[model samples]
Target chain A: MHYPNGKKNDQTQKTLANVSKSHAFSNRGMTLEEDINAANAFYRDTGKASIHKKPTPIQVVNVHYPKRSAAVITEGYFKQPSTTDYNGIYHGRHIDFEAKETKNKTRFPLANIHEHQIRHMKSIINHGGICFLIIRFSAHGETFYMPAETLFRYWDDQINGGKKSIRYETIANEGHIVPFHYQARVHYLAIIDKLYF
Target chain B: MHYPNGKKNDQTQKTLANVSKSHAFSNRGMTLEEDINAANAFYRDTGKASIHKKPTPIQVVNVHYPKRSAAVITEGYFKQPSTTDYNGIYHGRHIDFEAKETKNKTRFPLANIHEHQIRHMKSIINHGGICFLIIRFSAHGETFYMPAETLFRYWDDQINGGKKSIRYETIANEGHIVPFHYQARVHYLAIIDKLYF
Candidate 1:
């Protein structure tokens, strides 16, 4: 099967295998999403934060119901999300962010983010909520928490005919490296504490 | 066609007509969802607030892509949401809420809300985010904004073998009535301002 993006199922399987082989997934090779979910779960359990990954929005077209089972949606299409993936309350402040992973070793491409996502981030920042992006460089086995403000600068630079991608060195300097913990796998909130608080 | 809930599409149409006839829908008989969407749009346009109703979550089981056009989800199921419907940043505070409507005249049934939703509201409150419910009594032409704290009391009462429904009188006494506005539509934020700010 091929996705709308033209990526075949086998391609996705190969990518997953590559991720497991290249990245430091030591504990049964967990995906980036799994790590974040684990971290969020830890946060929720410990009263540290209350963040949740919003479910992928799908526009359902047709549904079929069996007499004795749950209703099944037979036709639908994936909808482009209007906002960031994760958002919630943190220290009485609205926390909004998007997380993305790239396998590139030298740079992170800005094209990985959608235009509407950038607009959404801007809106959050304007509303006085803390907004940021969590970027994972799988090739280097590193993750960084980059504030929305820094991201905006890069975004504007691109619009003004600058580099299309952010260099690894730039991210290293401007973004806070998120440490991976056993329990709190992606410890991005620790960076938020130091940066925002 | 009849939905799994046994409500025919025509019955829904009749209910909508009844809603327009009995309740306040000054603008060409808009539904409660439409009113809230309008309010949110106005809030966004005017920089008054940043709130959005999360899309209904659907779990896709199968998909098919034609030679051209968008990919179609062939099989799916409506997933129960883990959190409230509407959530965003208001005055730098995390704002979370669920909006519901009932055609019943005397009482609001507790069954209108899921148990997980009650738990989710509690978590939001514990995390210091402002949470509430926007309920529309279609039979009475009334709408009210009830705080999560007030909702928790009733929810807990039901769990303790108390009343399964909250009397309309209780809602009128404890909740703030949401006034209708020309541009702002539902104007629930006005109540939020008085209660929280």
Candidate 2:
């Protein structure tokens, strides 16, 4: 098949192999995305909050509609998102945050976050919304909720030729360790309640 | 091309004709979507507000990476969105809304809105977020901002066999008439300032 942009779908064989490898990894355990999705569902179902992860942005090049079926997108490319992963309202306050999981045990690399995402977070904070980062250290099975203010300080330092990553100790001291529950997998709201409310 | 769900993209040849008809109409002037996009850009540029139209959701069926440019989505289906089109934080308030346009001269059809969208709007209102609908009567060149509460009342009435569409007169009475500005095309926020803030 050819896209409207004339690109051929000829690498499907190789892509399927990559897809299987990722499927294998997902089959082994829950990913941070899955955990956060579950937590968001819990919050919604219980009327605790109304948060949602925005759909991954895609730049559609062509769409084809069948006679009796839904419209099919034949060609597209995943677009880099310019905002945070999750956002909603809690207690009349706009809540915005991004979640990331890393295998690194010593420090959280700044490369994990995009400059646009940092700018988005800065805008959210400036608008008086509650903005933060939920960082999960998978190696140590720990999650921390670091306020955007703290993150901005580190990000600014990096621009000034400072450390490129935040030390594990710094995050441990400054960020709130999010508690995990069976239903609410990543219970970051509990920390929000204590800190903000 | 076929979606993963075994749907073929065979109707494009027929749909293309219908698309051109709509394109011809849109070519006359700016579409409601374009106007709102321009207004959003103006709002962002002036630091007046931070709002964005959510990206259209596409359910990927197949993807291909040709070891050159970005990964190409070879097959996908356009997913029905579960929430409103536009949402963001405005002055510490969670702003959520959907915009629709109709050519009908007298009544705005409720069919333009989906069931899930109403449920999502209800949830936002329950969570204390600011929610509304922007309806444009293209035939009359008029736009109005109808609060979620007013929309819900009409929606519930429809369930009880009330009017299937809201009359233009009723909208004029209950909704704020949004004025047009050169820079901020659909100046709905002006009404928001009076009604909300």
Candidate 3:
């Protein structure tokens, strides 16, 4: 996506906004990230939640001063995040979670998550924050909210030579479904309200 | 600081750690950011807090895939942060704050913060989270914690043609002093304990 002359500013953000807007009428074509971003925007506008996705961490190697006012990163690489991507306050509770979309129909692979991320989620739960995972099954067009405590059991079992994936039936039985809405999109907060608040 | 050939990893983070280590013997040479980062690390290690400094946001304009596994950002620019730099859970409560250092002797300029950032801080406070500003006066070798409510009064005054900066004397009177320590360099949670829980 090359920026036009004099339009180099906010190309990344604009690209995301454009993607979200292009599929505004229906969410069938939108990615999970786009839907959550749109949902977060709606939550912010309605003063229901103040969540935000942290910017992707990057490590810059060399920078070039093309002009006095512009410093361009000539070489950089993405860094693995040490914590969950999205977090903020909700009704006085610290809300933290990671969201992922999978096309797998039968089971969700634990390989989709990193070990450190599981540790971070455990820490958030121990600290009494509302922590969970938002898993979107693209094949079924369904999103489910699995509490950190529930996920920890499977994670611990996986560490002890058990199955490497959680069956979709287990997730459906243990996790609450996140209904889609026109404005809220993913509508995970509705599940949070039922589970925690 | 340029990395040696084939040693390009976490250059920015290493630069900060190098700065922190070079000034380890004394607090005199440490920047506010370095000190706060040190404090946050100590807090995390001790399990007293789970705070983290949000990564610097960047607008990636272009990337080059020289190899299949690694993608390098070829052109990117810095993006202004939408909220405070640091936030996490503390003692089962949400904590959010921004830290700034000013070399000015008498006044801390309000221009150091953006208007939207102020609005974000206010929203955090309204949501029942603990939100404040950590201001470092290098000339005085002191840091003050100003609550969002206290800062809002001055912000409103600035909107009505008041002074563009807060006087050092006024800050000293209105804000709590953050003590410096060996391990917890900034020692802000102590002030938080005194004011809140």
Candidate 4:
């Protein structure tokens, strides 16, 4: 599959298709973003949590209604998002996060984040919301729920001569590893129950 | 002054223009959406709140950058928003609201709201967020903060025999009156402090 812009995959070692067959999991499907979205919807429907993905804000410049049956959005430019991706109430506490999937097995690069997003995350923390990042190492099939507080520490340390990227070992030590499932795909909230609630 | 859509104002009242004189006033006298955006920015900067106006999603068909400095978005159509106008955390509680300003003096019309927004607000309330509407009766020089719970009750009651439009008198009694100011233009958070905190 063609990766979106700003993503770097190890083209030499292995492809995602190869890993799926090795694992022998027929349910090895869905993008990380889609899974998390499904989980959120399930959570909301079950009266468990009410998080939602903010609609991707695109400035559409052109559309072609070919036959009135379907409207094709032809020309549009991506607008700078002014806020975090996902936000909602969970157990009467506000929850906010930005989800990203990386192909690197060794480390998740900080370049995946924008400076404005860091500022936004800090503001979310200051306002007393449960903030975090969902990092999925797609190649190794590992996902970690790293809290904003931990992210803040590393982000600030970068300014003071810390590592440019967060290693898998460091993430394993500090971040909660999320379990994958058939229904509620990411299942990060299960970790939230054990760690937070 | 003509509105952004080039619609001429029918009422002669100059409330918004007069209110925009102060340096702290928001939007530099733009649309109601602009004022709310400015208020949100101020709120975020001061660590007061995390509310944001979701950008109006648009489908673009064409863009012509005739000049290097100016990227003219030539052809675009608005997309129906899937959520409420503003949502964020305020002092550990989830805050969600939609804002609308009307020139109508005696009653606030319900037609200004999309059915989907009403559904979204209901979901927000079901999941424990504080949901409401900021109704500004510009002609009367009054703004009222009406809670979503109350609005829902009225909406449900309308099916049984309640009034279609909420009277100004009813709004004055049931809603929190928002005070206008130089810096905090809307100052709706003052009501939030009283009601939620």
Two-way lDDT contest, 3 vs 4, winner? 3
Candidate 3 residues lying further than 4 Å off, grouped into runs, are A1-4, A7-27, B1-27
Candidate 1 residues B140-163, lDDT tens each?
778899999999999999999999
- Give one digit per residue, the lDDT tens place, for model 3 in B83-174: 99999998998999999988788999999989999999988887889999999988788899999888888988999999899999999999
Best by DockQ: 3
Number of the candidate with higher lDDT, 1 or 3: 3
Query: Which whole-number lDDT from 0 to 100 does residue B26 have in model 2?
Result: 31
Winner of 1 and 2 under DockQ = 2
Residue B47 of model 3 has an lDDT of: 84
Q: Which residue pairs overlap in candidate 3's backbone?
A: none
Per-residue lDDT of candidate 2, residues A1-197 (tens digit): 22322232344445555555563332225667778889999998898888888998986667877776566788777888988889888888898999988888999999999998998888888888999999988778888999999999999999999999999999999999989889988898999999899
- Among residues 3 or more apart in sequence or in different chains, the pairs in candidate 1 whose N, CA or C atoms overlap within 3 Å are A73-B76
Report the C-alpha lDDT of model 4 over B129-164, residue by residue, as the tens digit. 899999877766677899998888777777588777
lDDT by residue (tens digit), candidate 3, A79-180: 889899999989999999999888889999999989999988888887889999999888888889999899999999999999899999999999999999
lDDT of 2 at A188: 89
**Candidate 2: regions farther than 4 A off:** A1-28, B1-28
Model 2 per-residue lDDT tens digits across residues B60-98: 768877664567787876778988999898887899999
**Which candidate model has the greater DockQ, 1 or 4?**
1
